[model samples]
Target: MDSEPPAAGIDVSKPHPARRYDYWLGGKNNFPADRASADVVAEAFPTIRLAALENRSFLRRAVDYLAEAGVRQFLDIGTGLPTAGNVHEIAQSIAPESRVVYVDNDPIVLLHARELLDSSPEGATAYLDADVRDPADILRKLDESRMLDLDRPVALMLVAIMHFITDDASPYELVRTLCDALPSGSYLVMSHATSDHMSAEELADTNAANQRSGVPFRLRTTEEFARFFTGLDLVSPGVGSVMAWRPGEWRPHPRPEAVAMLGAVARIP
Candidate 1:
Protein backbone atom coordinates (compact mmCIF):
# COMPACT_ATOMS: atom_id res chain seq x y z
CA MET A 1 0.00 0.00 0.00
CA ASP A 2 1.23 3.48 -0.82
CA SER A 3 2.16 5.66 2.12
CA GLU A 4 0.37 8.96 2.78
CA PRO A 5 0.34 11.67 5.41
CA PRO A 6 0.41 9.80 8.69
CA ALA A 7 -2.66 9.92 10.87
CA ALA A 8 -1.76 11.24 14.33
CA GLY A 9 -0.82 8.86 17.17
CA ILE A 10 -0.10 5.87 14.97
CA ASP A 11 2.63 3.50 16.23
CA VAL A 12 4.19 1.19 13.65
CA SER A 13 6.66 -0.65 15.86
CA LYS A 14 4.13 -2.28 18.17
CA PRO A 15 1.79 -4.73 16.47
CA HIS A 16 -1.74 -3.36 16.15
CA PRO A 17 -4.91 -5.41 16.21
CA ALA A 18 -5.80 -4.37 12.67
CA ARG A 19 -2.34 -5.16 11.33
CA ARG A 20 -2.22 -8.47 13.17
CA TYR A 21 -5.65 -9.24 11.77
CA ASP A 22 -4.36 -8.38 8.30
CA TYR A 23 -1.54 -10.86 8.83
CA TRP A 24 -3.96 -13.57 9.93
CA LEU A 25 -6.02 -13.01 6.77
CA GLY A 26 -2.97 -13.49 4.52
CA GLY A 27 -2.78 -9.83 3.61
CA LYS A 28 0.51 -7.91 3.13
CA ASN A 29 -0.68 -4.75 4.88
CA ASN A 30 0.96 -5.88 8.13
CA PHE A 31 4.56 -5.35 9.20
CA PRO A 32 7.10 -8.04 10.10
CA ALA A 33 6.46 -7.42 13.79
CA ASP A 34 2.81 -8.32 13.29
CA ARG A 35 3.65 -11.34 11.13
CA ALA A 36 6.04 -12.67 13.77
CA SER A 37 3.31 -12.49 16.38
CA ALA A 38 0.66 -13.94 14.08
CA ASP A 39 3.00 -16.79 13.13
CA VAL A 40 3.51 -17.68 16.77
CA VAL A 41 -0.22 -17.72 17.45
CA ALA A 42 -0.89 -19.71 14.29
CA GLU A 43 1.76 -22.25 15.25
CA ALA A 44 0.22 -22.59 18.70
CA PHE A 45 -3.18 -23.12 17.09
CA PRO A 46 -3.72 -24.03 13.43
CA THR A 47 -7.36 -22.90 13.31
CA ILE A 48 -6.30 -19.28 13.64
CA ARG A 49 -5.80 -19.05 9.87
CA LEU A 50 -9.12 -20.67 9.07
CA ALA A 51 -10.82 -18.52 11.67
CA ALA A 52 -9.69 -15.40 9.84
CA LEU A 53 -11.04 -16.73 6.54
CA GLU A 54 -14.27 -17.77 8.18
CA ASN A 55 -14.57 -14.34 9.75
CA ARG A 56 -14.36 -12.80 6.30
CA SER A 57 -17.12 -15.06 5.10
CA PHE A 58 -19.23 -14.12 8.07
CA LEU A 59 -18.69 -10.44 7.30
CA ARG A 60 -19.80 -10.92 3.71
CA ARG A 61 -22.92 -12.82 4.68
CA ALA A 62 -23.89 -10.32 7.34
CA VAL A 63 -23.40 -7.34 5.07
CA ASP A 64 -25.38 -9.04 2.34
CA TYR A 65 -28.21 -9.67 4.75
CA LEU A 66 -28.29 -6.04 5.81
CA ALA A 67 -28.18 -4.81 2.25
CA GLU A 68 -31.05 -7.06 1.33
CA ALA A 69 -32.92 -5.80 4.34
CA GLY A 70 -33.10 -2.33 2.70
CA VAL A 71 -30.46 -0.66 4.82
CA ARG A 72 -28.56 1.74 2.56
CA GLN A 73 -26.10 3.43 4.90
CA PHE A 74 -23.22 1.87 6.86
CA LEU A 75 -20.71 2.90 9.48
CA ASP A 76 -17.92 0.31 9.79
CA ILE A 77 -15.81 1.00 12.84
CA GLY A 78 -12.38 -0.51 13.44
CA THR A 79 -11.96 -0.71 9.72
CA GLY A 80 -8.91 -2.80 8.98
CA LEU A 81 -6.63 -2.84 5.98
CA PRO A 82 -8.60 -3.02 2.76
CA THR A 83 -8.87 -6.54 1.39
CA ALA A 84 -10.52 -8.35 -1.53
CA GLY A 85 -14.17 -7.76 -0.47
CA ASN A 86 -14.98 -4.70 1.67
CA VAL A 87 -18.17 -3.50 3.36
CA HIS A 88 -18.78 -0.70 0.85
CA GLU A 89 -18.24 -2.98 -2.13
CA ILE A 90 -20.43 -5.73 -0.79
CA ALA A 91 -23.27 -3.47 0.28
CA GLN A 92 -23.14 -1.22 -2.75
CA SER A 93 -23.25 -4.21 -5.03
CA ILE A 94 -26.65 -5.02 -3.58
CA ALA A 95 -27.76 -1.40 -3.53
CA PRO A 96 -25.79 0.98 -5.69
CA GLU A 97 -26.70 4.03 -3.65
CA SER A 98 -25.39 2.70 -0.33
CA ARG A 99 -23.29 5.19 1.59
CA VAL A 100 -20.49 3.92 3.86
CA VAL A 101 -18.09 5.59 6.23
CA TYR A 102 -15.21 3.43 7.52
CA VAL A 103 -13.49 4.57 10.70
CA ASP A 104 -10.10 3.38 11.98
CA ASN A 105 -7.23 4.86 13.95
CA ASP A 106 -4.55 3.19 11.83
CA PRO A 107 -2.84 5.54 9.41
CA ILE A 108 -1.97 2.59 7.18
CA VAL A 109 -5.60 1.66 6.81
CA LEU A 110 -6.64 5.26 6.27
CA LEU A 111 -3.93 5.79 3.67
CA HIS A 112 -4.55 2.60 1.70
CA ALA A 113 -8.33 2.78 1.98
CA ARG A 114 -8.55 6.30 0.59
CA GLU A 115 -6.20 5.65 -2.32
CA LEU A 116 -7.32 2.27 -3.64
CA LEU A 117 -10.79 1.41 -2.34
CA ASP A 118 -12.79 3.45 -4.79
CA SER A 119 -16.58 3.57 -4.50
CA SER A 120 -19.49 3.95 -6.89
CA PRO A 121 -20.36 7.47 -7.97
CA GLU A 122 -23.95 7.23 -6.87
CA GLY A 123 -22.87 5.85 -3.51
CA ALA A 124 -20.20 7.25 -1.19
CA THR A 125 -17.21 5.77 0.71
CA ALA A 126 -15.02 7.74 3.08
CA TYR A 127 -12.52 7.01 5.86
CA LEU A 128 -12.27 8.57 9.32
CA ASP A 129 -9.10 8.60 11.35
CA ALA A 130 -10.81 7.96 14.65
CA ASP A 131 -10.62 5.37 17.41
CA VAL A 132 -13.51 3.18 18.51
CA ARG A 133 -12.95 4.05 22.17
CA ASP A 134 -14.35 7.53 21.55
CA PRO A 135 -17.69 7.37 19.82
CA ALA A 136 -18.03 11.11 20.15
CA ASP A 137 -15.07 11.73 17.93
CA ILE A 138 -16.45 9.33 15.37
CA LEU A 139 -19.86 10.95 15.45
CA ARG A 140 -18.36 14.42 15.24
CA LYS A 141 -16.31 13.53 12.21
CA LEU A 142 -19.21 11.79 10.54
CA ASP A 143 -21.40 14.82 11.14
CA GLU A 144 -18.80 17.31 10.00
CA SER A 145 -17.94 15.23 6.97
CA ARG A 146 -21.59 14.41 6.28
CA MET A 147 -20.56 11.04 4.90
CA LEU A 148 -23.49 9.24 6.48
CA ASP A 149 -27.00 10.31 7.26
CA LEU A 150 -27.72 9.72 10.93
CA ASP A 151 -31.45 10.27 10.43
CA ARG A 152 -31.80 7.29 8.15
CA PRO A 153 -31.52 3.56 8.76
CA VAL A 154 -27.89 2.40 8.68
CA ALA A 155 -26.01 -0.83 9.10
CA LEU A 156 -23.39 -0.56 11.83
CA MET A 157 -20.79 -3.16 10.94
CA LEU A 158 -18.52 -3.98 13.92
CA VAL A 159 -17.27 -7.37 12.81
CA ALA A 160 -14.28 -8.98 14.54
CA ILE A 161 -13.23 -5.67 16.03
CA MET A 162 -14.51 -5.31 19.58
CA HIS A 163 -12.24 -7.89 21.32
CA PHE A 164 -9.41 -5.35 21.29
CA ILE A 165 -11.39 -3.38 23.83
CA THR A 166 -11.23 -4.33 27.49
CA ASP A 167 -13.85 -4.04 30.23
CA ASP A 168 -12.58 -0.70 31.52
CA ALA A 169 -13.20 0.84 28.14
CA SER A 170 -16.89 -0.07 28.38
CA PRO A 171 -17.19 -1.73 24.98
CA TYR A 172 -20.82 -2.58 25.65
CA GLU A 173 -21.68 1.05 26.34
CA LEU A 174 -19.73 2.20 23.35
CA VAL A 175 -21.71 -0.15 21.14
CA ARG A 176 -24.92 1.10 22.64
CA THR A 177 -23.97 4.72 22.08
CA LEU A 178 -23.27 4.13 18.42
CA CYS A 179 -26.30 1.97 17.87
CA ASP A 180 -28.55 4.42 19.66
CA ALA A 181 -27.56 7.13 17.18
CA LEU A 182 -29.20 5.30 14.32
CA PRO A 183 -32.91 5.33 13.57
CA SER A 184 -35.08 2.30 14.12
CA GLY A 185 -34.63 -0.60 11.69
CA SER A 186 -30.89 0.01 11.65
CA TYR A 187 -28.60 -3.03 12.11
CA LEU A 188 -25.63 -3.86 14.35
CA VAL A 189 -23.39 -6.66 13.09
CA MET A 190 -20.41 -7.96 15.07
CA SER A 191 -17.91 -10.81 15.32
CA HIS A 192 -15.85 -11.17 18.46
CA ALA A 193 -12.85 -13.37 19.22
CA THR A 194 -13.31 -15.71 22.15
CA SER A 195 -12.00 -18.98 23.60
CA ASP A 196 -15.46 -20.51 23.98
CA HIS A 197 -14.70 -23.15 21.37
CA MET A 198 -11.05 -23.80 22.08
CA SER A 199 -9.28 -26.31 24.26
CA ALA A 200 -7.63 -25.03 27.44
CA GLU A 201 -4.15 -25.49 25.99
CA GLU A 202 -5.03 -23.66 22.78
CA LEU A 203 -6.61 -20.78 24.65
CA ALA A 204 -3.58 -20.46 26.91
CA ASP A 205 -1.13 -20.41 24.01
CA THR A 206 -3.21 -17.95 22.03
CA ASN A 207 -3.74 -15.62 24.96
CA ALA A 208 -0.10 -15.83 25.99
CA ALA A 209 1.12 -15.00 22.51
CA ASN A 210 -1.31 -12.10 22.22
CA GLN A 211 -0.33 -10.74 25.63
CA ARG A 212 3.33 -11.09 24.73
CA SER A 213 2.67 -9.06 21.62
CA GLY A 214 1.08 -6.39 23.85
CA VAL A 215 -2.49 -6.92 22.61
CA PRO A 216 -4.20 -9.13 25.17
CA PHE A 217 -7.14 -11.26 24.16
CA ARG A 218 -10.27 -11.47 26.29
CA LEU A 219 -12.42 -14.33 25.04
CA ARG A 220 -15.87 -13.56 26.41
CA THR A 221 -18.61 -16.06 27.07
CA THR A 222 -21.42 -16.13 24.52
CA GLU A 223 -23.59 -14.40 27.05
CA GLU A 224 -21.03 -11.66 27.61
CA PHE A 225 -20.80 -11.04 23.89
CA ALA A 226 -24.56 -11.13 23.59
CA ARG A 227 -24.85 -8.37 26.16
CA PHE A 228 -23.55 -5.89 23.59
CA PHE A 229 -26.89 -6.24 21.85
CA THR A 230 -29.00 -5.71 24.94
CA GLY A 231 -31.36 -3.11 23.45
CA LEU A 232 -31.53 -4.60 20.00
CA ASP A 233 -33.65 -7.42 18.61
CA LEU A 234 -31.49 -10.32 17.49
CA VAL A 235 -32.09 -11.76 14.06
CA SER A 236 -32.95 -15.39 13.73
CA PRO A 237 -30.03 -17.75 14.60
CA GLY A 238 -28.86 -15.21 17.22
CA VAL A 239 -25.17 -15.50 18.22
CA GLY A 240 -23.31 -18.55 17.00
CA SER A 241 -19.91 -19.60 15.74
CA VAL A 242 -19.42 -17.83 12.42
CA MET A 243 -19.41 -21.15 10.56
CA ALA A 244 -22.72 -22.25 12.02
CA TRP A 245 -24.56 -18.94 11.47
CA ARG A 246 -25.68 -18.88 7.84
CA PRO A 247 -22.67 -20.86 6.57
CA GLY A 248 -24.22 -20.56 3.03
CA GLU A 249 -22.66 -23.43 1.06
CA TRP A 250 -19.11 -22.21 1.58
CA ARG A 251 -17.93 -25.54 2.97
CA PRO A 252 -18.59 -29.13 1.99
CA HIS A 253 -18.30 -30.46 5.53
CA PRO A 254 -18.81 -28.69 8.83
CA ARG A 255 -16.12 -28.91 11.49
CA PRO A 256 -17.11 -28.01 15.03
CA GLU A 257 -13.73 -26.75 16.16
CA ALA A 258 -14.25 -24.18 18.88
CA VAL A 259 -13.97 -20.96 16.91
CA ALA A 260 -12.40 -18.22 18.95
CA MET A 261 -14.78 -15.89 17.11
CA LEU A 262 -18.52 -15.47 17.68
CA GLY A 263 -20.73 -13.54 15.23
CA ALA A 264 -24.20 -12.01 15.30
CA VAL A 265 -26.47 -9.53 13.49
CA ALA A 266 -29.25 -7.60 15.19
CA ARG A 267 -31.68 -4.79 14.48
CA ILE A 268 -31.84 -1.66 16.57
CA PRO A 269 -35.28 -0.96 18.06
Candidate 2:
Protein backbone atom coordinates (compact mmCIF):
# COMPACT_ATOMS: atom_id res chain seq x y z
CA MET A 1 0.00 0.00 0.00
CA ASP A 2 1.61 3.25 -1.11
CA SER A 3 0.97 5.86 1.58
CA GLU A 4 -0.52 9.12 0.37
CA PRO A 5 1.87 12.06 0.43
CA PRO A 6 0.55 15.09 2.28
CA ALA A 7 -1.44 17.45 0.10
CA ALA A 8 -2.66 20.95 0.95
CA GLY A 9 -5.61 20.89 3.39
CA ILE A 10 -5.36 17.12 3.91
CA ASP A 11 -4.50 15.71 7.33
CA VAL A 12 -3.22 12.15 7.27
CA SER A 13 -3.38 12.10 11.07
CA LYS A 14 -7.16 11.73 10.78
CA PRO A 15 -9.10 9.06 8.91
CA HIS A 16 -11.33 9.76 5.93
CA PRO A 17 -14.20 7.56 4.71
CA ALA A 18 -12.75 7.05 1.23
CA ARG A 19 -9.45 5.88 2.62
CA ARG A 20 -11.19 3.74 5.23
CA TYR A 21 -13.25 2.19 2.46
CA ASP A 22 -10.16 1.66 0.37
CA TYR A 23 -8.64 -0.24 3.28
CA TRP A 24 -11.75 -2.38 3.56
CA LEU A 25 -11.70 -3.21 -0.15
CA GLY A 26 -8.09 -4.45 0.06
CA GLY A 27 -6.79 -1.46 -1.85
CA LYS A 28 -3.35 0.06 -1.27
CA ASN A 29 -4.41 3.73 -1.15
CA ASN A 30 -4.86 4.28 2.56
CA PHE A 31 -3.00 5.43 5.67
CA PRO A 32 -2.38 4.14 9.18
CA ALA A 33 -5.14 6.38 10.56
CA ASP A 34 -7.65 4.94 8.12
CA ARG A 35 -6.54 1.41 8.89
CA ALA A 36 -6.86 1.97 12.62
CA SER A 37 -10.35 3.45 12.28
CA ALA A 38 -11.42 0.65 9.95
CA ASP A 39 -10.10 -1.93 12.37
CA VAL A 40 -12.13 -0.41 15.18
CA VAL A 41 -15.34 -0.73 13.20
CA ALA A 42 -14.44 -4.21 12.00
CA GLU A 43 -13.84 -5.28 15.57
CA ALA A 44 -17.37 -4.20 16.42
CA PHE A 45 -19.05 -5.43 13.21
CA PRO A 46 -17.28 -8.43 11.80
CA THR A 47 -18.94 -8.02 8.41
CA ILE A 48 -17.84 -4.43 7.77
CA ARG A 49 -15.41 -5.55 5.07
CA LEU A 50 -18.02 -7.79 3.49
CA ALA A 51 -20.46 -4.91 3.48
CA ALA A 52 -17.95 -2.70 1.63
CA LEU A 53 -17.20 -5.41 -0.93
CA GLU A 54 -20.90 -6.24 -1.42
CA ASN A 55 -21.76 -2.54 -1.78
CA ARG A 56 -19.15 -2.36 -4.55
CA SER A 57 -20.70 -5.34 -6.29
CA PHE A 58 -24.09 -3.64 -6.07
CA LEU A 59 -22.62 -0.58 -7.86
CA ARG A 60 -21.50 -2.80 -10.74
CA ARG A 61 -24.88 -4.53 -10.95
CA ALA A 62 -26.72 -1.20 -10.93
CA VAL A 63 -24.49 0.19 -13.70
CA ASP A 64 -25.07 -2.97 -15.73
CA TYR A 65 -28.81 -2.67 -15.26
CA LEU A 66 -28.89 1.00 -16.26
CA ALA A 67 -26.69 0.52 -19.34
CA GLU A 68 -28.93 -2.25 -20.63
CA ALA A 69 -31.91 0.04 -19.98
CA GLY A 70 -30.33 2.70 -22.28
CA VAL A 71 -28.93 5.25 -19.81
CA ARG A 72 -25.73 6.70 -21.30
CA GLN A 73 -24.85 9.37 -18.76
CA PHE A 74 -23.81 8.90 -15.12
CA LEU A 75 -23.28 11.44 -12.30
CA ASP A 76 -21.47 9.58 -9.56
CA ILE A 77 -21.20 11.69 -6.39
CA GLY A 78 -19.09 10.78 -3.41
CA THR A 79 -16.85 9.10 -5.94
CA GLY A 80 -14.32 7.13 -3.93
CA LEU A 81 -11.00 5.79 -5.10
CA PRO A 82 -11.04 4.62 -8.69
CA THR A 83 -10.84 0.85 -8.73
CA ALA A 84 -11.68 -1.90 -11.19
CA GLY A 85 -15.23 -1.92 -12.59
CA ASN A 86 -15.74 1.85 -12.20
CA VAL A 87 -19.00 3.38 -13.45
CA HIS A 88 -17.78 4.39 -16.93
CA GLU A 89 -15.97 1.10 -17.39
CA ILE A 90 -19.09 -0.95 -16.71
CA ALA A 91 -21.38 1.36 -18.68
CA GLN A 92 -19.02 1.73 -21.62
CA SER A 93 -18.52 -2.02 -21.83
CA ILE A 94 -22.20 -2.39 -22.75
CA ALA A 95 -22.70 0.96 -24.44
CA PRO A 96 -19.47 2.49 -25.66
CA GLU A 97 -20.93 5.99 -25.80
CA SER A 98 -21.62 6.35 -22.07
CA ARG A 99 -20.44 9.57 -20.40
CA VAL A 100 -19.69 9.77 -16.68
CA VAL A 101 -18.61 12.55 -14.31
CA TYR A 102 -17.12 11.46 -11.00
CA VAL A 103 -17.28 13.88 -8.04
CA ASP A 104 -15.52 13.85 -4.71
CA ASN A 105 -14.42 16.53 -2.19
CA ASP A 106 -11.40 14.70 -0.87
CA PRO A 107 -8.08 16.11 -2.02
CA ILE A 108 -6.62 12.62 -2.25
CA VAL A 109 -9.34 11.57 -4.68
CA LEU A 110 -8.58 14.66 -6.73
CA LEU A 111 -4.90 13.72 -6.77
CA HIS A 112 -5.80 10.36 -8.32
CA ALA A 113 -8.41 11.85 -10.62
CA ARG A 114 -6.26 10.83 -13.56
CA GLU A 115 -7.14 7.18 -12.93
CA LEU A 116 -10.82 7.91 -13.62
CA LEU A 117 -10.10 10.10 -16.65
CA ASP A 118 -9.23 7.10 -18.81
CA SER A 119 -12.36 7.01 -20.95
CA SER A 120 -13.31 4.65 -23.75
CA PRO A 121 -12.69 6.01 -27.25
CA GLU A 122 -16.39 6.38 -27.87
CA GLY A 123 -17.26 7.56 -24.36
CA ALA A 124 -16.14 10.36 -22.02
CA THR A 125 -15.25 10.54 -18.30
CA ALA A 126 -14.36 13.47 -16.05
CA TYR A 127 -13.60 13.89 -12.34
CA LEU A 128 -14.81 16.90 -10.35
CA ASP A 129 -13.38 17.97 -7.01
CA ALA A 130 -16.55 18.97 -5.20
CA ASP A 131 -18.68 18.05 -2.23
CA VAL A 132 -22.02 16.29 -2.52
CA ARG A 133 -23.50 18.54 0.16
CA ASP A 134 -23.08 21.44 -2.25
CA PRO A 135 -25.38 20.21 -5.00
CA ALA A 136 -25.48 23.64 -6.60
CA ASP A 137 -21.75 23.77 -7.26
CA ILE A 138 -21.74 20.22 -8.58
CA LEU A 139 -24.52 20.99 -11.03
CA ARG A 140 -22.84 24.23 -12.02
CA LYS A 141 -19.62 22.39 -12.83
CA LEU A 142 -21.51 19.66 -14.70
CA ASP A 143 -23.27 22.27 -16.79
CA GLU A 144 -20.03 24.08 -17.50
CA SER A 145 -18.16 20.95 -18.54
CA ARG A 146 -21.00 19.54 -20.67
CA MET A 147 -19.79 16.12 -19.67
CA LEU A 148 -23.37 15.18 -18.86
CA ASP A 149 -26.62 16.66 -20.06
CA LEU A 150 -29.27 17.37 -17.44
CA ASP A 151 -31.88 17.26 -20.23
CA ARG A 152 -31.25 13.54 -20.64
CA PRO A 153 -31.61 10.57 -18.33
CA VAL A 154 -28.62 9.77 -16.10
CA ALA A 155 -27.89 7.20 -13.41
CA LEU A 156 -26.99 8.93 -10.13
CA MET A 157 -24.63 6.68 -8.22
CA LEU A 158 -24.69 7.33 -4.44
CA VAL A 159 -23.46 3.97 -3.30
CA ALA A 160 -22.28 3.58 0.32
CA ILE A 161 -21.60 7.28 0.71
CA MET A 162 -24.78 8.74 2.24
CA HIS A 163 -24.24 7.19 5.63
CA PHE A 164 -21.36 9.56 6.17
CA ILE A 165 -23.72 12.53 5.96
CA THR A 166 -25.32 12.99 9.34
CA ASP A 167 -28.96 13.92 9.74
CA ASP A 168 -28.04 17.49 10.69
CA ALA A 169 -26.52 17.88 7.23
CA SER A 170 -29.97 17.37 5.67
CA PRO A 171 -28.90 14.30 3.74
CA TYR A 172 -32.34 13.58 2.32
CA GLU A 173 -32.77 17.08 0.92
CA LEU A 174 -29.25 16.98 -0.43
CA VAL A 175 -30.17 13.84 -2.33
CA ARG A 176 -33.47 15.32 -3.51
CA THR A 177 -31.70 18.43 -4.77
CA LEU A 178 -29.45 16.28 -6.91
CA CYS A 179 -32.30 14.07 -8.14
CA ASP A 180 -34.38 17.09 -9.01
CA ALA A 181 -31.72 18.25 -11.45
CA LEU A 182 -32.08 15.17 -13.66
CA PRO A 183 -34.67 14.48 -16.35
CA SER A 184 -37.72 12.36 -15.60
CA GLY A 185 -36.31 9.04 -16.79
CA SER A 186 -33.14 9.36 -14.73
CA TYR A 187 -32.37 6.88 -11.93
CA LEU A 188 -30.81 7.06 -8.43
CA VAL A 189 -28.81 4.10 -7.18
CA MET A 190 -27.97 4.20 -3.45
CA SER A 191 -26.68 1.96 -0.68
CA HIS A 192 -26.62 3.14 2.94
CA ALA A 193 -25.32 1.67 6.20
CA THR A 194 -27.87 0.62 8.81
CA SER A 195 -28.07 -0.91 12.26
CA ASP A 196 -31.28 -2.79 11.33
CA HIS A 197 -29.33 -5.99 10.76
CA MET A 198 -27.25 -5.87 13.91
CA SER A 199 -27.75 -7.47 17.28
CA ALA A 200 -28.08 -5.20 20.32
CA GLU A 201 -24.50 -5.78 21.36
CA GLU A 202 -23.20 -5.29 17.86
CA LEU A 203 -25.01 -2.01 17.55
CA ALA A 204 -23.46 -0.75 20.77
CA ASP A 205 -19.98 -1.61 19.62
CA THR A 206 -20.47 0.03 16.24
CA ASN A 207 -21.99 3.11 17.82
CA ALA A 208 -18.92 3.41 20.00
CA ALA A 209 -16.60 3.03 17.07
CA ASN A 210 -18.47 5.70 15.10
CA GLN A 211 -17.80 8.36 17.73
CA ARG A 212 -14.09 8.18 16.99
CA SER A 213 -14.33 7.32 13.28
CA GLY A 214 -13.23 10.90 12.32
CA VAL A 215 -16.41 11.62 10.38
CA PRO A 216 -20.12 12.16 10.91
CA PHE A 217 -21.94 8.86 10.24
CA ARG A 218 -25.57 7.93 10.62
CA LEU A 219 -26.67 4.33 10.35
CA ARG A 220 -30.37 4.69 9.65
CA THR A 221 -33.04 2.00 9.71
CA THR A 222 -34.84 0.57 6.69
CA GLU A 223 -37.72 3.01 7.10
CA GLU A 224 -35.38 5.97 7.51
CA PHE A 225 -33.29 4.92 4.52
CA ALA A 226 -36.37 4.72 2.32
CA ARG A 227 -37.11 8.42 2.86
CA PHE A 228 -34.43 9.42 0.35
CA PHE A 229 -36.59 7.91 -2.45
CA THR A 230 -39.81 9.51 -1.29
CA GLY A 231 -40.92 10.95 -4.64
CA LEU A 232 -39.25 8.41 -6.90
CA ASP A 233 -40.54 5.10 -8.24
CA LEU A 234 -38.63 2.25 -6.65
CA VAL A 235 -37.47 -0.68 -8.76
CA SER A 236 -38.50 -4.24 -7.92
CA PRO A 237 -37.32 -5.78 -4.65
CA GLY A 238 -36.55 -2.28 -3.45
CA VAL A 239 -34.73 -1.29 -0.27
CA GLY A 240 -33.07 -4.49 0.79
CA SER A 241 -29.53 -5.68 1.44
CA VAL A 242 -27.15 -4.79 -1.39
CA MET A 243 -25.98 -8.38 -1.46
CA ALA A 244 -29.56 -9.46 -2.11
CA TRP A 245 -30.54 -6.79 -4.66
CA ARG A 246 -30.51 -8.43 -8.10
CA PRO A 247 -27.84 -10.95 -7.27
CA GLY A 248 -28.80 -12.55 -10.62
CA GLU A 249 -27.33 -16.05 -11.04
CA TRP A 250 -25.35 -15.55 -7.86
CA ARG A 251 -28.54 -16.49 -6.01
CA PRO A 252 -27.12 -17.55 -2.69
CA HIS A 253 -25.63 -14.18 -1.73
CA PRO A 254 -24.30 -13.98 1.80
CA ARG A 255 -26.85 -13.30 4.53
CA PRO A 256 -28.41 -9.83 4.47
CA GLU A 257 -27.71 -9.44 8.18
CA ALA A 258 -24.04 -9.96 7.48
CA VAL A 259 -23.98 -7.34 4.71
CA ALA A 260 -25.83 -4.61 6.73
CA MET A 261 -26.19 -2.13 3.86
CA LEU A 262 -29.51 -1.32 2.17
CA GLY A 263 -29.41 -0.91 -1.60
CA ALA A 264 -32.09 0.41 -3.96
CA VAL A 265 -32.67 1.91 -7.42
CA ALA A 266 -35.46 4.40 -8.01
CA ARG A 267 -36.56 6.06 -11.24
CA ILE A 268 -37.61 9.70 -11.32
CA PRO A 269 -41.05 9.97 -12.86
lDDT of 2 at 81: 88
Best by lDDT: 2
Worst 10 residues of 1 by lDDT: 1-10
Candidate 2 CA-lDDT value: 0.90
TM-score of each: 0.92, 0.96
**What is the lDDT of every predicted structure here?**
0.82, 0.90
Model 2 spans with C-alpha error above 4 angstroms: 2-4, 7-9
RMSD from true fold, candidate 2: 1.3
Give lDDT: candidate 2, residue 83: 90
Supply the TM-score for candidate 1.
Answer: 0.92
